[model samples]
Target: MATMEWIAACREELYALREELHRCPELSHQEYRTSALIEKQLRAWGIPVLDFHLETGVVAKISGGHSGKLLVLREDIDALPIQENTGLPFSSQVSGVCHACGHDIHTTALLGAARLLSEHRDQLHGDVLLVFQCAEESFDGAASMLAHGIFSAQTPNAVVGFHCAPQLQVGKVEISAGIREASCDSLTLTVVGKGGHGAHPDECIDPVVMSAGLLMQLQTLVSRRNKATDPVVLTFGEIHGGSAPNVIPDQVLLRGTLRTFDNRVRMAHLAALEDLCTGFCRALGGTCTVTVEKSLPPLINSPDICQQLLTSAQTVLGEDCLGSESAPSMGSDDFSCMLEACGNHGAQYLVGTGLENDPATRMGLHVAENIFPSQAIEPAAATLVQFALDYLN
Candidate 1:
């Protein structure tokens, strides 16, 4: 079947699947219902399905008649913990959960592509693996899947995935050769001191004061320590300590995020953070504990795979749909784990699809409740279809 004919055959079914998935959104690691829905759809279409090591994710495989290379396509199957606010007809039915980050769209697009491929199985080469992963919101899902041996069975020659862009036009595609996203690390610091009466400042170590100093110093990690040329963000999002204003608290807690694109800079910044917090607390006659947890690594696209994606996107959507030199986003994705697992297997990952056309369209990241137009869905599916065919041919 021709690419357009295959896409047309599955367009309506894809829309229905997308809306259904959108209405019943599930958060990371809790995608039981979503998994069942996806499994059922793929089974009905006669694609062979496999349960993920993590119960919340699914993997399906389709084989072409001819012998060629294996290609893997992945989509995250999770939502965020945000209340829906888009007020669309098919807005999230789960009140405190939403597919605001367009994972719903991504999954739908993959499924649409799956249907198209299943319909044209005779034209396909080798095999195509459809990976629906869970827990992208937390950095752990992809890591967990890897640890549990998801990719040990079959490694693809190339892996591909895309994220929805709220800033770009709906159907447009963006490609970057390397360092497409920043490395993310979560940090929490506990400051300990002695509690005493507020009036007796000398009696207490004053954790609140210590916390303030630590926060100020943390900000300097980027300006003073990190290279100014590299992108770095140190943001303290939460701080908690004293119970009452009159009582000097014995302990204060600080939580924040560290983001950087360069690995060397990321490691150095983390080390400096620990050293600064330890020194400040010791000098202030208090105790401190700094725990840094590494999240996703920087998303680096392979040059050859990036070139293939660029060519395929231009062929499908023309040169106007291609994006140039877009800035790297600080947000991280668990899909980076898949890329890591496929190391030396010649895998490549790229993000596609721009945000809605209107400048006033206010869509929140990941968990915000907003409905992207259904029109954007078709072109994204079509793009993937063309890209997959190009890879196979």
Candidate 2:
């Protein structure tokens, strides 16, 4: 079968694989079953998997009949800590864990591409590396795999990967030139104060009050300190403190994230956040300690690689399916780590897997009601295959 015909023929198998993965979702760094399934599938296709040190990641290589450039195609295989409410028959059977971010689709699509590439390897020229990476949700699985030198001897000429985008319609793909994703830095703030009765307003140095002030102050780093064009977002999603209504806690813990497009801006924001939080707590007669856990860098796509992938996408999915120059999001991915490790020659594209054009039916990533269309698997696989073929040629 030809490229398109082959992808079409394997749609059922791809869907079944995706559903199986969805039903049996696994968390980051704990994807033993997921990794084993990928290993089994790749080995069945006669591909040679390199040695992997990470517990839940797998890396396999497929070489054509002749020698040429190397290409790496990666897929993240992990589920989020979300209970499924999608009401689908294949919904997560594993309680409190679901493939809400569509990693299931990503895994199945890459598996489909693997099958097609293995079948068409006779017509190919160069080597293709399939990386079924793990723990992309909260853990930096990509970086973990790289730290073990998974690709020390098999560096690729170019790399390509994909993510599921709910906003765009099915069969569509989006490719951006630079800063595809923002840099992510996690923040932990501890406010220490004297504990007393909540009713006694002036008797105790309330850390809860200090934490509230700190949260409000941090927002200014984005709104007042940073330039409008810089695009900075600081959001605190978790705060834990007091026990009872009348009891004032001795300490309050704040957890949040910092996202920025530019590295300089990211650093500046982190510095300002620490300084401001410390100052605020000190002025309010409380002590504060700010801990910043640095994560992946911004995912900036190489313009030359984007152009090549765009051409491949247009050819495979038609011109109408191509989305470019769209607004970049504040969302971050550990794929940035993969790109950096791959010599910064890779591009991660967004594949629209929404079931319909209507917004109501479209599901957002990490939401409890995520319903990624199974239809997108074939198109995504086809585009990725085309990208590899074109790059190798």
Candidate 3:
């Protein structure tokens, strides 16, 4: 039987697994139950599981009848900390946690590929490494796995992964070469000042004022420092200061992320941010400190490999469903770490999950109410399976 034939045979099972996963979402590094369930399913499919001894996550292997190349198929399995509002029959059972990022779809697609590919082992020319990873929500799962020697024994010839796009219709697939996603730097800036009664405006240093001024300065840094063609985003999502209406807080905390398409610009922006905050605050009788705690590099895809997958995906979704020149996204993914290991031999693309004319299904990812039709799974899985077969054969 062909790959799709095998995939079709297992479609119902895949849907059940997806719902099972959706009903019980787990947070990053806390996917013990998720990992166990994944391991159980892989074992039942007669695939060999590798003992990575990971606290959470699963790694399994499917060897070809003849060996020629090694390809890695990776998926992230962690959920976001968002309350469920879709009210699907299989809403997240966990409180304050849901698979709002479509990781549930990614995981299910990879597992479907695993099952169908295992059935086609005799026809395969290379092995497939199935990586169901955890902690992707924090953008360090791939790095953490690499640190623990996930690729120590042998590096793969190529790695492939996909993220669900809620904005695109379900039958379409998009791939782009070069920089496909932005790099992310988590920024935390603290403005410190002397606290005083609100009534006495002259006595207090007024860090709230300092923080607001510095945020505007940060925006100017992005606009003036970077080229107009190069995109940069500096967002301060959370601002916290002052406890009461009558008293001024000693300090204010501002947390945000810096996303940039260029590496040099990212570095320059970081330096400028520190200088701007320190200089701007001290001049106003306050002090500020900026901390960049975590960073994820831009997702760069291989042109040649992207073309190969474009053809492969066209076989699954008709030729008209393939797109290769779409604008790159600013969202970040940890899969770029794996691409860094394999050089330009890997690519990650977008799999459309949106339904036409359905406002409810068009909500952006990471939103609590974000949802997609189940019909989107077949094309994604079939495309993955076909790509693996084409490359390996």
Candidate 4:
């Protein structure tokens, strides 16, 4: 923190930018305004921008007059579909769209680093790619950009990304040497049954009842079937069935997600879930259709790259500001796609953004009550700038 006095002096501007971005939060592929703003800012700073095939993403490059190794610095710019309730002065103006996951902060920090690095380009030894990615909330934004030939121009030697961590206080960072986040896959189960009038006793095979039973049975997949030592999280967040009180619906839809670390465990869980859903519905004289949408894979950090980042982090922010070990999480991220696309030459870390000594201001990501302090912008932005400089040099 002491090594970034320059970033401290620019904190006010970064905070204002963060607030400005927070107010106009956009969801997934709909970050048109956000992308335009980022591109405009980079261009204004004399940095060259790339007009990628994406609808709402910007890829910019900064060369230090001599290119050696290319380093990619990524910051996801998409917000969630949640509504704002933080009551901040710069709360989201868009209804039913909020930056609950702190993408606003991530975007601001990247912009800040861009400005700082541009100012000191003469001191850089290589090229830096700024990836303001969109639709990260959709789990396919990175792939979209890649499909549009994001890497067709030049493959990066290393890719680095950061996410705001509310669990840790501002001025701290967590770098993982192994798996940081779990793989995610969504499952939609459609249970079909006979529709009937409420007065009928045996005329209908009730889907609502079968769905309820299936939900209970699905809970056992993790607890009973999977090994206790293995980690897996199965959550059913959406379930819809009949609409009327007197009539039973023919089909009930169940939407849920499965998160796991190991590939074998993830595949086994999917197979088990499909089998259980099908078997339960068939035995009940009904039919079930299961559809699985594959999402992000488990985010695994490259040990060598993480070690380099660890050393750089300790030098820039001090030892106390860097955690010894990152706590594994069931939460998943599409940044894993970037690492996989880069051929395992990339890594990610968490930048603490929670307020210090203010428990009331600290909350988990993607929650309605989540809110972070603006002062956190300085440390986060400074860390990004320093990391880029360290890696490039």
Model 3: weakest 10-residue lDDT segment is: 1-10
The TM-score of predicted model 3 comes to: 0.91
Give the per-residue lDDT digits (tens) of candidate 3, residues 1-70. 6555677788899999999999999999999888998999999989998987788888898999998898
Misplaced by over 4 Å in model 1 are 344-369
Ranking by lDDT: 3, 4, 2, 1
For model 1, how many clashes?
A: 1
What tens-digit string does per-residue lDDT give for candidate 2 at 272-342? Answer: 88889888999999999989774778889999988988888888788888854567778899988888888
Task: Give me the runs in candidate 2 sitting further than 4 Å from their true place.
Answer: 196-204, 357-361
Error of 4 at 96 (Å): 4.1
Displacement of residue 128 (Cα, Å) in model 3 is 1.8
Candidate 3: residue 99 lDDT (0-100) = 94
lDDT for model 2: 0.86
Compose the digit string of candidate 1's lDDT tens values, residues 1-393.
456556667678778888999899999899999999988989999999875556688888889888898888888889888898877788889979888788888889888888888887788877888888888887777787777677778777878878776656666777777777788888899999999999998988999999998888888888887778989999889998888879998999999898888778888888898999999999999989999874677777888887787778777667787755677778777676788778822323334434444432435455354456665666677777777788887
Q: Write the per-residue lDDT of candidate 4 for residues 7-36, one digit (tens) a residue.
A: 877788888889889999999999999998
Clashing residue pairs, candidate 4?
Answer: none
**Best prediction by lDDT:** 3
Q: TM-score of every model? A: 0.91, 0.91, 0.91, 0.91
Cα-based lDDT at residue 82, candidate 3: 96
